[model samples]
Target: MSTVTGSTTAAISSAVATTTAAAQASVQAAAQSIISGSTNSSMDTSSLVTALVNSKTAGQAATIAAEQTADNTLISAYGTLSAGLSALQAAILPLSDGATLNTFKTTLSGTGVTATAATGAVAGSYSLNVAQVATSQVLTSAGYNASTNLASGSATMTLTVNGQSSTISLNSSNSSIAGIASAINSANDNPGVTATVVTGSDGAHLVLQSNSTGASSGISIAISDSTSTDDLNKLAVTTTAGKSISSASDLTGTDSSGNTINPSQSTISGTGWTQTQAAQDSYFTLGGVGVSSSTNAVNTALSGVTLNLTSAAVGTTQTLTVAQDTSAESSAIDNFVTVYNTLVTTMGSLTTYNASSTSQGVLLGDSTLSVIQNQLAKIVGSGVGSGTTKTTLAAIGITLQADGTLSVDDTTLNAALQNNQSAVTSLFNPTTGIAAQLDDSITNYTSSGGIIQNRTDAINSDLTSLSNQQTTLTAWQAQLTSQYTAQFTALDTLMATMNNNSQYLTQLFGGTNSAGALATNKG
Candidate 1:
């Protein structure tokens, strides 16, 4: 408690001890207040710390913003390029297949028949007259009690189909009618025959039918057994008529008037089995020439045409026409043109500059993109064949437009296909075709380790680097905040002590500066 104001200033100055020049200046200003004995003063530490931290980290924030923009643009570019290349690949797949080009289309004028023409079929029209279609052999065994076992001990049955024979064993272990039917159906080598046990109100009857549809493909069954010959022989059947019973049995019948009477009924079973329906070849005529087929699907009667007989009306005639499938060929070329245009448009967007954004595209100046664009333009216009009438894509229907997209002239393409189909096909030859060349070019960019993949990987690496940089910037900002907060708090503490000392000095002495009063009083 000194009456001299200069002594109060000396005490406050001695308390202000700090290494930073700014912190020292703040403490000195507080000392001056004590000499003047003033109390209306404040040190806003919170506001000062906020300002200092912001100023220190502004450069890093700007860097982060720029990096984020670049990362977003690059990611978008990869997606656009990948989708564009995949679409181009799908558009040219049909033209790349040789089988599709050689395929012949067939048409039928009559509802009685359908036709399919194979590869290399000559373009021609022929009249077809179906006399009778092929029929399969059918045989039914005598109705037996379904629960009864028909065979005793062991017996072997031989089944023949289309001149091929397979033997099935019949024994007490599989002697039931159901068991025997299952055994015949499950036979590993059984050819063109299926055995089934059909149940009716009378009983269960074993029905054996030929899987094929001709006399040469009929089924023949024979039993080799010494015992139970009567039961085993019942399963045997022959296509040669009259070898077994084909006679009528008297059955109870009901008339439309509801009167019960005796009616003659034909039975297909006896001591042995006989054919109910004989296997016969299909009879038809091609261009008034007689022909025969063992099956309804007639393949060999014509050179490359296969006729399937649906219904046989002896007097009816149908027309079968085989011709080049020009529509299919044209459609394939059209698809290729469409996909090419899509790819070109996407690439243009990715490489174009946007004045609104004041920025160029992410891939604007990429050398790889330039290479892809130049190569694609060259491929569509170049000639693709040597010994062909149509040499280039432009010679046909597909031609490049001013905007780097492909356009098709359908009339021109169809004429080329109609005139020399081989030459048109050669233009898309698997070895050196327009479609092949385009496919090759697209694969270079879309396949593994391609240019697009490499570029994507580089962008990903850059994103990783950016993430690391953001982390480092965040840590640097945190450190700066801690440093600023500590310095301002220290300065505020010095100023508050100085203010308290000044108030005490003014109460003991006066509110105004008293340095001159102290010197005169000392004199």
Candidate 2:
């Protein structure tokens, strides 16, 4: 009996152990199946969620790409058009004004004078005789040792020229003649006076010069000293009754015209310096007529010619000739033709459609661009002036080619300018000519709220909408992913729970065999 009891207990224990092991294996398999997902009864949640979101958002992504591409193309097209228009505008400028059209070339006969001609210069010859060039007033102080301080304490000096006056302050650094010269030069309110320090065999001295050249303008200086016997006063003859430097007068000087300054008791007294050279005006003759000018650059004698007199002699003369500049007019027209042809070619290539090549330009078949091209053609083809003397561009050698660009006949254009300069002037005058019309048209297309700007703005707006939609789709995809993941995770947990319960029941029943039967068999 004891042997049977022990055998029955061992058989039951073995059965229970086998069933428990199988149940655990099943529970693990079920958990793995649920987490991995399957077909039909279960769902491949991750792939489905990604596929659905991608399918819904694909159209929006494609639209964004298309808008971006279109915007890029529009930007490129507008930039190219603007560059061409700018070039055309520059070409139009030289021909628009009457003053620019009446240009003249000037020639000088000799080295004594050089002349420049302006638009108003009438074609004529002029003889120029330079008698005397202009001069500036110069005053020199008596020589002193190089290291001598010209200032005692702080002193103020006044310089007057050309009805203007400036006060100069002397400090320690500017106590010497050199430093004083620097200070005078650096004074902000100084009208037309300059100072310099000159070194001679004897010693250094201060020299003051007026920048104004004529007799009407000269330099005057007065000094007031606060310390000691006034350094500036000591440097000159003392005017005070008993002060003992030279009693003679350096303050008594002559004007630029050699007129003497009358001596008076109030006049400041002398230094050893003398009036070396008097300031004089430049004397010259224009067109055989005697003329005088305060400056060497004589502009008033001739209508538009400014004569820069380089030398002065009593009988020496120069001939100034002003003539029409036909070559300049021809060159300007030629440049216009060249630049216009280039602009037309660029725009043509952009707007044309090619049957042979599959590629199309960014701006091909654009209606606004087509209208602009038409307007340009009309402006180029239209007659320039009102009269019946063949005022159209064809008469001036600027003709439109079949490909819609301009061509220039240099000989014809030059001949036309020579024959009728006024007609040419009227052709491009900004007030009432073809160039004015073209300018107005281009302004409408290029300025603010213009056609090109409006198109660009619309494209930008579309791109912005596409960008916003893409953002919304992206957020929706993330939400879908989270929702799917949570659903699948919960399903997996439920499946695992059911599997665990089945395993527990199978172990309790011992897999279709009773525990008692197994114990009896062992007996």
Candidate 3:
């Protein structure tokens, strides 16, 4: 009875072991299937491709268009001043063989001025004293009407220069020491004489000054009006010319059109060159309204110049010369045209249609770009151009083509340049011409939302989607791993128990009955 029961148990154990092994294989197989199908990377790249279909592709094309537009703007701007550019660029470079910075000492001097302080900042006649006016301090000067205001208050004021005498009037309110000073300086306007109430420890005193530095430039002031009076209207002034012979006077120059040029404002003259002074020049106004005794002109004394407020004098006007980068401007113009021509040729070639198959090129058939290109052509053709100096594109190397593209007809351009230099110089100079407009247009296309924007946006959007998908996929993978682990572990435990019982039962039989052993046993 024991033998028969043991044999039956052994058979049962063997059957269960085989079943457990099969179950493990099934569990693992299922796990693998789940893992394979559940991986998030399994999503096709085709979907990403689909999402990037339209404007993204167009944006890539826009980069090329944008470059062409930039080229056009530069070239159009360059045409008017091509020749000067190379020289200007070269001159800007220092002898150090690289971009070099240089420090320079500049001195201001003219014929009529005496500088008290030679260097650094000192109290001054002129107040270059930089005062930051509070926004609130800006008195709306335009609203004040000078007609009703008292001019000056003083009795009889007489001025004599080299025995030439003039009668002057003065009002009390307008001719306080400050008013008399103002009137004296105002009377000496043509002679460059300036006056002001000089305040000292004692009290306020009327002081006279001149615009020139030399002995011939010294001016004398005599306050003939004993009673305080308004004295501004007392002196006579010449209509067109300025002659400051006294220390209180200042120099004034005017263009042929009678536009007065103040030394304080203009850096250059009509010819575009800096002014050269053999001696110092002085600036002054009456009653200290704009005059001062400090060595400085406005606030601090100007270097290389000396000013003396000894008396008032008529001052001479010095012609101003403007600084010009003619050579650099010329070269810049030439480079611009070159870039422009190259740009258009390149763009048209890239964007034009191919007579054959489905191979469309960059910017091909882009209508908006075509319009922009035409606009550039017009600028190169006949937009705002510099007058006289460089007025035409052909004067440079740029030539307009029948097809709306421009070319560097070097020979024609060189001739135009040689024959009419100013016309060529005026062509693309943006300061007053078409180049400015075209440059502005180019700016519009490259900014945010320009051609490159859409493509960049698409790439960013796609990357964001990819990141989200990865997160979700990673979570799915974790779940799959857990499921796989649990299923395999259960199978492993069952298999181990089954194999142990099968071995024990088989051993108990000693060698089970021949047929049963043969069916279940392994070699």
* Model 3: per-residue Cα lDDT over 72-105, one tens digit each: 3333333222223233223323311211111122
Query: Of 1 and 3, which scores higher on lDDT?
Result: 1
TM-score of each: 0.73, 0.71, 0.32
The residue-level lDDT of candidate 1 at 434 comes to 73
lDDT of 2 by residue, 456-511 (tens): 67766766776787688778878867876787668756766676776666655546
Segments in model 3 whose C-alpha atoms lie over 4 Å from true places: 1-326, 337-395, 399-411, 421-434, 449-451, 498-523
lDDT for each of the candidates? 0.70, 0.67, 0.40
Check candidate 1 and list the clashing pairs. none
Q: Which ten residues in a row have the lowest lDDT in candidate 2?
A: 238-247
Best by lDDT: 1
Query: Model 2, which residues run further than 4 Å from truth?
Result: 1-45, 97-99, 145-159, 166-191, 221-271, 312-315, 387-390, 475-523
lDDT per residue (tens digit) for residues 201-235 in model 1? 87777778889876566666788877755477777
Q: What lDDT does candidate 3 reach at residue 485?
A: 52
Residue pairs clashing, model 2: 250-270
